[model samples]
Target: MPIIEMKQIVKIFEDPKRKTNLLAIDHVDLNVEENEFLCILGPSGCGKSTLLNMIAGFEKQTSGDVLMNQKRVDAPGPERGVVFQQPTLMPWLPVWENVSFHLKLEGVAASIRKERAKEYIEMVGLKGFENHYPHELSGGMNQRVGIARALMLNPSVILMDEPFASIDAQTKTDMQEELVKIWEKHKITIIFITHSIDEALILGTKVAVMTRRPGTIRETMSISLPRPRDVTSDAFNRYKRQILDLLKEEGELAKAASRSSS
Candidate 1:
């Protein structure tokens, strides 16, 4: 079975007084297979995050169904882990504590939590920084802590929302490489949201290009390029050009709609 199934999913934000409420996602259908890295790419306000939230059980679809392994998603569960744009860690806690906070919340023993935290902290390349606080680390390192924190749940799927967007270019590239390594080693299914076509090309096994709001999948393309991708290669640039053209069409349509509506 596909790890996650989004069937005819539509998401609308209702307002009692307003005649027209916000309709973010249209009737979109997608199947996320097991152990594949899927990247969702679209313009701002295009419901990429909304669609991800639905799969994470953080938001309910207005209609249709979002299922994980044949089960409908209604609420957040341990089975679906989430890493947001910001690390959002506890300022007072050290890296290890932040990583194991949920275990602490669940009344897990301190010694066990410490050992578990060590395992993931090391996995994310933060072995010696376990004792360091959030403020003590660089932006990229803090995000690594966030990734380790999510991995602590041992979730079946990890949903990320532009997680490396705020980092420096070099760090972002390095993080991308590390993430690919983690995906390969763990064999975990990941659904990542991003605005960068290059990042999508680098990280995804499958890329879903979405249209402007009332966002739906414009196309889902399988990316078969070899790992440690060379962006200068013909195949990489071809995919980039294709996505750029599709996004350009959506941008033009959006502008025309604005002019007509006025």
Candidate 2:
């Protein structure tokens, strides 16, 4: 059985002005396999993030269901860890403390937390800056801390919401490489959300192209790209162009909807 399943999920948001309910997601069904790296790619408001939120158990669907390992998901648990766009770290806490925050919540001792955080800190290549605050680190470094914090939970599934979107090109590439390395080493299942075609192509085993507002699954293209994906390679460009065309189709539909409403 698929490790994660969403069966005909639907989510609607009521708009007071339109006096209408907007369907953010529509009859979306997906099955994610074990240790698979999946990317949900679409334009803004396509409900990619909303789908991730549902899997994280932070949001509920208007209808249908979400299941993991044959059990219904009703609430957030340590088995699933999410890294939002922003770091969301505790400003007052040091790097190690932030990474070990979950353990603290579980009433683990300071020494134990410190030791556990140390291992993840090193995993994300943030060893020497254990004493630093969030403000002290660069954008990419802070994001690494966010990832490390999530890893410290030892969650089997890691959900990322455009986690590298805020960093510079160079730093983003570095982080992406490191993330793939981590995924390979730990064999963790990752469900990533992004608007960037290149990011999706480079990272995912399956690239799930989503439709525009009232989002639905348009296609789930198997990447088949070899690891250490070269963005400049011909194969990479080939898939990128194909995915771009798919997204363009969604964009045209969105424009038509806007014009009809206007």
Candidate 3:
């Protein structure tokens, strides 16, 4: 069985003014296998983040079901870790403390927590910065701390919602390479949300493209490109061109739908 399954998910948000209910997701179905890097790509307002939220158990679907390991998911659990757009670290705490905070809350001893945090900090390339606070680190370095914190939990899956969105282009590329290294080393399952097709292409084992508002999975295509994918290669461009066409077609359809509704 697939490790994660979303069967016919639908999410509707209420508008306070009774103007109209917003259907953010419409009957979307998806399944992810173990240790797969699945990147979800869509235009803004396409509910890509919403889908990730559901998988993380931060939100529930309006209809259908979300299952992990053949069991229904109703609330957030430690089995699924999440890294949001921001590091969301405790500014006052140092990197080691932030990475092992959950363990601290669970009444783990300080020595054990420190030792455990050490493993993940090194894994994320933050070995010597254990004493550094969030403010002392660069954006990409802080993001790496967030990733280490998530990995500290030894989660079955890690859900990322554009965790590198705010970084510079060069920093973003470096982080991407590090993330791929992490994934390759640990063989961790990841579900990432992004608007950048190139980023998705570079990271995911497969990319799932979504439509605009009231988003649904338009298609899920396997990358099949070799590691350290040559972006300049013919195969790479072909995949890029294919996804571009899908996005363009979806954009046009969304605009037409809005015009008709108005």
TM-score of 3: 0.98
Ranking by lDDT: 1, 3, 2
List model 3 lDDT by residue over 1-262, tens digit each. 7899999999999888977899999999999999999999988998999999998888989999999999999999899999999999999999999999999999999899999999999988889999999999999999999999999888999999999999999999988999999999988899999989899999999999999888999999999999898889999999999999999999899889889999
Q: After superposition, which runs of candidate 2 have C-alpha atoms over 4 Å from their true positions?
A: 16-18
Off by over 4 Å in 3: none
Comparing 2 and 3 on TM-score, the stronger one? 3
Q: After superposition, how far is residue 247 of candidate 2 from its true place, in Å?
A: 0.9
Clashing pairs in model 3, backbone N/Cα/C closer than 3 A: none
Off by over 4 Å in 1: 17-19
Relative to the unseen true structure, what is the C-alpha lDDT of residue 239 in candidate 3, on a scale of 0 to 100? 96
User: What's the CA RMSD of model 3 in angstroms?
Assistant: 1.0
Report the Cα lDDT for residue 82, model 2: 94
TM-score of each: 0.98, 0.97, 0.98
Residue 4 in candidate 1, Cα distance off native in Å: 0.3
**Per-candidate local distance difference test:** 0.95, 0.93, 0.94
